[model samples]
Target chain A: MDLENQKRVKDLTEEYGPENVVVLLGAAEGEASGIAAETVTAGDPTYAGPLTGVSLGLVVYHVCEDEVKEEFDPDVYDEQVSMMEMVLDIDEIAEEMQAIREEYTKY
Target chain B: MKGAGYILVHTPDMITHYGTTQTSERIVNPESEYLKNIEANLRPYERVRAYYPNQTYIGNITPLELKEIEGPWQDLECPVDERYGKYGEIMPQDEFYLLIQAVDEFELVFLEKSFVEATKPKLEQDPIITPYVLGRIKEGVESERIDDMVASEDAEGLYMGDKLVGAVKKAHAFDPNLSAHVMVENLVSKASSALALMYAVKNAGIDRDEVEYTIECSEEACGDMNQRGGGNFAKGIAEIAELSRSTGSDVRGFCAAPAHAVLVAAGLVKAGIFKTVAVVAGGSTAKLGMNGKDHVKKGLPILEDVLGGFAVIISENDGVNPELNTDVVGWHSVGTGSAPQNVIASLTTDALDKVGLKVTDVDYYSPEMQNPDITKPAGAGDVPTANLKMIGALAVRRGDIDRKELNAFVEKHGLPGYAPTQGHIPSGVPFMGHARDGILSGEMNRVMIVGKGSLFLGRMTNLFDGVSFLMEPNSGPKEEAAGVSTDEIRRIIAQSLRDFASGLVEAGE
Candidate 1:
């Protein structure tokens, strides 16, 4: 994640309280999605961004995950995200998000 | 007033075969997946020509045209035949390759005999290239000589359709900075900048001889080993463009260099140091495929395939063109925080405060105009939109706009990011040509150009850098200064006092 987004996540978590915030990531690759999920929850794994050592432990999910997908209107989801869904390796992305959530998501 | 010209050189071969990202990755991992996928993802010249954003870049179509056309521009059908635009042209790769050699003064670039013979005529036909420039393309060397250098002399091969058409030889035996790869990259920058400068002169209706000075603000640095960044890119570009009366120097500030150079140019003109100053920048080979991995991973076309170049000619305000407001310039000091909001405030409100103008008073705000198509797949988000939102948030904080009006403010003031992610090229400078026209035509009253740089990229400083200035319709020609010197005034005052004393003595007698 870029520094601006990192700052935004941190600010939003502080503003609304950690329990109310959830990050929906739309990265193409499992690893990138996982890294971003880890960044918001466990601080930046790369140790190079604003989130470093400031773990929010907020809830996070990849947009490809079933938990996030079910919340969207099916028609809207199909219209907006179905093409990307067809190309993505959802199982890998979901597994990464689940792993990060299991390890670090306190809220 | 400053006349801006911009061009995009579609160098797919350069992106795939020689871009620093690809070449560096190849050296580290020759069979990288991105490299393997490159050949399949490369867009043909025809598709590149028809891409909507590209059409806008070369001025073949207006930004408003995109609003009517449904896009994902890659999938949009835009049949454009003309490569030229109001600002400049979108040059194809083959002609650009010949230009790269044409601009070379060191004879370091060698082209295959057959390839040059075939491409020379096409290059000669471009109106931008004068006969003098066309004559600069060397009679081609034998293919064997180029191939042997690539195999034995560490020369970087230039390829077209898998055939080696040219090679750039290393300038030194052991100097990494003077290596063949670096030479090729610098030559590309020089060539593209020269082309843009030529267009700027042509578009502005100014004689080439009128360009008295040039400031090159590209990210590329040209020099030998002893002085790695010791640059005369401005002079090199001037030489190629044949700006006979111009002398120049380079200014480097990462992505913010163009804004800085433009301000510097404006100041020079305002100070009467130069009657006309062209601030020019060429594209970077390193930046060509900077985001390829992200695009390729997402099953998207490699949109960062084109190198971007721009030239802006700053002249004495003619009372008709938009005047660059040097008085209300913004600077991001070392003390300024690097937070997004802070940076935006520094660039927008801080400068606006000087002129007693509210954020809403400005007609448009152009920040980092990085094409979202390129940045979004790379996980950078919509950069221009993000910038506008920050500026909008700042407006809300200052009560210049209500919180509910933030979105509307953004919608009104923001422009879509259409520029290539060529670092300095996208940093609030790309829209200058449009802004000039909009102001001149009374469509816009004021537009601010903001440039932001990441100083941390150099590892020399943690401070962020930025500069901004407003462009508004010229108020009118400035009143000329009174001619009398202070010494002359003093002498006249003393003479009047003496006369008064003599008159008083005469009257008393």
Candidate 2:
């Protein structure tokens, strides 16, 4: 690893704040994503193609039960699934979203 | 703009790991160590097997053509990491019983064994509810056979779970109750995902009201890829959960949604307009794609899982989880991102630039944690792990850190593989909750949470990829300038909010 690239990233960060900086994730899937990547990264000399990500699913969520139906009855199982309520509280961001939801519902 | 005020880390209720091994044949209790291991992983959270009404043929749509399946999928051709193909291209696909996980209540110290499993299970072997319901509906309509799908607003008698459950029941027009005992788990995959997410909130002690926004990330096939019917019908799952109150929008960003979600939460909090935002994602077991039985006959384990789900809460409020660096630098900058190749460069550098931290300053980088073993079964090679290595190498190249150091970072902090290849579920950002916990406990400082979405995978043209990193310090709560009670604070803010609304109303004129 060389300090030159580090400084380049450093200077770029200074010029563009963290919110505005665009570090390309070198995930090269084909089709539109490939074209977009080429247009964005290859089009710009500053674009960094090599990138990475973490598989957070294993960390945050886990399999509580697999192969559920072999022993369980689907009718009994679905009843339980329905009995349990699924709720998402949006009041937290109600201020900005009230209008959008109303519009979406109208659509 | 500034650091999050209070961050909370939740021990997941359960890590519902499902293995891919079932064949298309209607095998009864077949033996496969992979299948056994999957069952072993899901033993914690109360797993639900919901019977989705009008599933059509989710239970028996095994693509049996690609026959001649065999051993573990990883043992097949193109085992290398670079091979790219839609996972569903493989086969031996069988009926998928979507599994969902959640902790009954909030708790930390993630020893998943202590987590309670969701009791909701999907469709059982016998699925005869549709005929029964159609008979019931015949009492009112002239035709016993349904001419239009539930989407037809004019259809007199309709039954799909939603807010109209009460109205439908009173009218006796729809009956999900008749086929009872012969349960058929509906493709309520999103609900399964949400069930697991609620645990992240409660176990982490996140207040439902504290969450100002919820960013839901799932596959392009979510709600069946159709605009209207995809949302959990009749159930009004989104509203019942109260994901949005008077504020917030349902952000649909494909696989990159989880990352996009967290960034949205962070943005709202940083702007001081909101206090909390939770980025949530659900699972879809039916994406068994076109592979399934075809792969099974071809000797590949069934890539579809019976269950799995994950969620992370990001907030500016205190007492829930450790706050991520509120200073966001780059967001794949729309037209300036790559597919998966450039995910790291765009994500890592963007955040580092905000705090003036170089690539090496990133104590660690985490990416698509897709298990190669699972993905290979689906025809999508080792994509997740490949992203991780790329970032580690990038750290070394920048001279910001050494190759050994970066390698050590991944080796030590990297999560043990467990999640099923549930498309958007096992993405890079899922680890943020646990990593944030580790960071606060002095395990590390500044973890880079990079998330990216594949818009092209959904066949959407003019679409672009999105990636962003959430940076956090390895320390405890930071001191604030002053203190105020929540009620008083809410009142004060509400007054301003009321004024802001009034202004918007006036301006609209």
Candidate 3:
């Protein structure tokens, strides 16, 4: 992450607490393998540093892992340190994600 | 049943090749986060059977080939065991690239001169699609102009791998009204719809000028900030396909938009408002690889790569084609609660009840048929199966079938889902062309298309949305025309005048 975005992400994490701060990494505009707009939420095992921050880069967090996913490990994967794309209200983001999941979920 | 185009554009899988280390180098900050930790050795995406060539994807197979495909191409296995069938040929990536360029040309998507020069030969050599390319390609914009425009940030280039295939120039310089992203998206939407319409015109045996109106039901919004979602994807598409006499507009309801459009188009044709009306949709880029992470994790190639588009034409009931049973309409009203069972019952059982039809009366049900392969690894289970089982359960509760007969009911009524995950593209419209063929051939008595939407996504409302209608074999004799003919009016007027004159003479005497 750039110094400017790094500072912004740090400030956000401080304000919202590390548990609530979710980071999303967007593949640069022309990457061949990963989807250009693929997004992964940062948390317990997966949240690490050395994030990618480009245009439309941002952070989303203040997530309750229990409510959102049964499990999330940022550390098990490469630590993500992407630039803050957009810092959304964590609860709202969770609700939206949950809604999307429910669309395909059976009753 | 007019025509359908299920196209597949195979992309090269260079990006998915595992064991290749890719490093991004930044000069200013050599240790930039993007350079330091992006996944280097990524697995290459393999071409799946469904993506290669088959009847399910209308594009690889032409309308003629599609006509030859037997009904119920989807296997009826408990878990979908196969993705590809023996119906159509799989188009290779290079050919698809040329096809997309041809499509761009058809829509007047200008390319830099050098780019066109490099690509022109590849397009010419392809015997299969050469005719299409020759028929569509027009004049090219100079590469110098493209360079200048890109330098000035006035255009966005269309990239395939590292190659710059084409670019979208800004429609206007000072029009914040037309941002680059909006222009690009609209351009893509327009080009795709045009390709589908072209196929439809040929497949449906209808002249381009015969279409009187069109409805573009894609989820993409074309207009600017002042009127964000205000659109005419219909007019843009009609213009491209040379629908000389057609006029059009757009309707949006997320995934349910196509079903709503179908209902609207059917009503228009049945009411004699127009001889032929079309409901068309183009795919979305945002949805491409939407579930990629899960697929990648499970060692599965990204299946959502294809940008899906479809077009359905509703025309005058010619006794041979299937009729849109307008009376048997289902709606998910505002008060219809959001529970899954409630939604299924409201959109299916209740509507069928109103039409005096039992749950088992309909031969087939097409709900949100998102391909399970793409959703399953993502932890979103078999969506089509879930829908079918719910309908079966409802049938059981209504005494339409025994509890033990639910699996049989599903097997009889449902087919494996084959649609891409483009939100609106999969909502009950993919199977329309097949359904039309079945009904016309006397193989299917009734097929109901159910379109459901999550209205709360818009943040303005919490209510869920849905609309469904049945298509059946044309029970001969068209529904009454919406208005009386001029000759009928004249006869009525003449009789009334005579009666008045006779009454006047009698009173005078």
Note the DockQ of each predicted structure.
0.05, 0.01, 0.04
Question: How does chain B score by TM in each prediction?
Answer: 0.92, 0.55, 0.77
Write the residue-wise lDDT of candidate 3 on B1-509 in tens digits.
Answer: 55554443333331221101111123334564432332331212233432322335553232233324433332222121122211112344433434444554323255656656666676566333325446666446776665666667776665555555555666655576575545665665665666566666655666778899999998888666678777988987777777889999899999999999999998888778998998888766556566554555555555555656778888876545678888889998877766555677788988888868998899989898777766666645556766788788767766789978987887788856667787888898877877776675578899999998877777799888999989888675444532546575455345434533542353233
TM-score of chain A of 3: 0.29
Q: Under CAPRI classification, how is model 1 graded?
A: incorrect
- Lowest lDDT block of 10, candidate 2 chain B: B83-92
Backbone clash total for model 3 is 33
Q: How much does each candidate deviate at the interface, measured as C-alpha RMSD after superposition?
A: 12.7, 19.2, 18.0
Off by over 4 Å in 2: A1-107, B1-187, B206-212, B220-235, B242-248, B289-300, B337-342, B377-379, B399-417, B462-464, B474-481, B484-509
What TM value does model 1 have? 0.81
Q: Each model's RMSD to truth, in Å?
A: 14.1, 23.1, 15.0
User: Would you list the rank order by DockQ, best first?
Assistant: 1, 3, 2
Task: Look at candidate 1 and give me any clashing residue pairs.
Answer: none
Instruction: Tell me the fnat of candidate 1.
Output: 0.00
Cα lDDT, model 3, residue B196? 66
Error of 1 at B442 (Å): 0.9
2 versus 3: better lDDT goes to: 3
